[model samples]
Target: MTQIIRTSADLRDRVAAWKRSGILVGVVPTMGALHDGHMSLVREARKQSDRVIVTIFVNPMQFNNASDLDKYPRDEAHDLAMLEAEGVDVLFAPGVNEVYPDGFATKVSVSGISEPLEGAFRPGHFDGVATVVSKLFGMTQAGRAFFGEKDWQQLQVVRRLVEDLNIPIRIIGCPTIREPDGLAMSSRNVRLSEAERAQAPALHRIMTAAAEQIRAGAPIETALEQAKAEILAAGFHDIEYLEVRSVEGLRPMETFSEPGRMLVAAYLGDVRLIDNIAV
Candidate 1:
């Protein structure tokens, strides 16, 4: 059985015991509504560390839209079953007050890399992520943290935050897990209508096709524009951004580069889908 530990104090005590045992700890921070994508991170943590802790607290500060936050899926019973099946050692499901007490004033914000894409589209989203993640690291006192690359930018932000602040934790990035149809798995995907669900995989298809084209010497802007048009045609109405950017620093790329990735964020019905592929 996986132990469910809440409250930072209880977490500190358990982590202290592990510290005494001299075992390496890995933390997988998630928003609950556990999916195979999140399990993939737990799997990686299990392999890489002696002990694993998965945090399930959908931090309210991370959601820019109140409704989106309100609608974010959560089922602790189901999540715990999945974590137990995965052999996770502990599941830290903290309450809002446990994680964010009254008069929580500090906010962690990363500049430069966080400015474009999701940051620009969802104002202050990364700040919320950074702050909560920082708190998670402190609470778990884990030596390594695992995050999936499905959220490429968010992964980068966490990496930057850990390094900039000298948090003394190793950040391990796991590859993105996707459906057989190629749609990146996300909690929000469940909200898509049946028709929208059918069209969702096209986002991944477009990024892959665009990546190949760019690699084959096609003009970056031309490939991206064509991808944007195709996404709209595929029934994604709000094509927020479709860009090819450097893997590091996330600088926009207009030409072939060794470490570049093609990223897209579009909406199907009301569900927002984001997918990225290496270029």
Candidate 2:
């Protein structure tokens, strides 16, 4: 039975009152289609703070394709039920008008790290993520915020933004949740037809294999090529990008760096899926 705060003013008022009463708040930001991955974040937030705030905003600014934004799933009633069951204390579900009333005149963009891989695929995507996240951090005044490690690069960008902007909230990255078949749990998974869902696990499987190859002293270029071959052979129509980068700064690597990650994005039919595995 968590209260839903749909406006910035209401969120600030509640958070300010909570602060006066010494209540520590934790936040989980999402784009409305709540799944097990999102619930995991809420549960983690519940463990660390007196109250948990879950924001459901599709964030139009983050989409490079207008159709992608239009096609994003949204079910407020179902999402609210899931949040309530997970013990979330507040649901900040705002309309686009409320969150970006000025038609997005300004945005937050990070240099260096924001211009590669996912950034290259969807231009200005991180800018939208950073801007909306900054607004959420300010509105909720969260003592801590929870994010999934599935979007590892995006998590890093947020971490940098928090540090550079001197935001007081502690950002915690939760582990990536996955299906029994090993496919990373995602809201977009719903868009996959039955056969596509069965084939989607190949992305994770390939990344896992690539990580093993790197650990076994295989050449980075050869391992990546093998991984790409594996995915392509598994019926992935388009391989957007598959790369191994240093975990610290997400820079591309020519050799295995001991501790890094394999990042992959592919299109199965029309649905775009992304996944990563640590090396």
Q: Model 1: how far is 171 from its true place, Å? A: 0.3
Worst 10 residues of 1 by lDDT: 253-262
Question: Each candidate's lDDT (Cα)?
Answer: 0.92, 0.92
- Residue-wise C-alpha lDDT for candidate 1, range 151-232, written one tens digit per residue: 9999999999999999999999999999999989999988888888898888889889888888999999999889888889
- Cα-based lDDT at residue 109, candidate 1: 96
Name the regions of candidate 1 deviating beyond 4 angstroms: none
Error in Å for residue 144 of model 2: 0.6
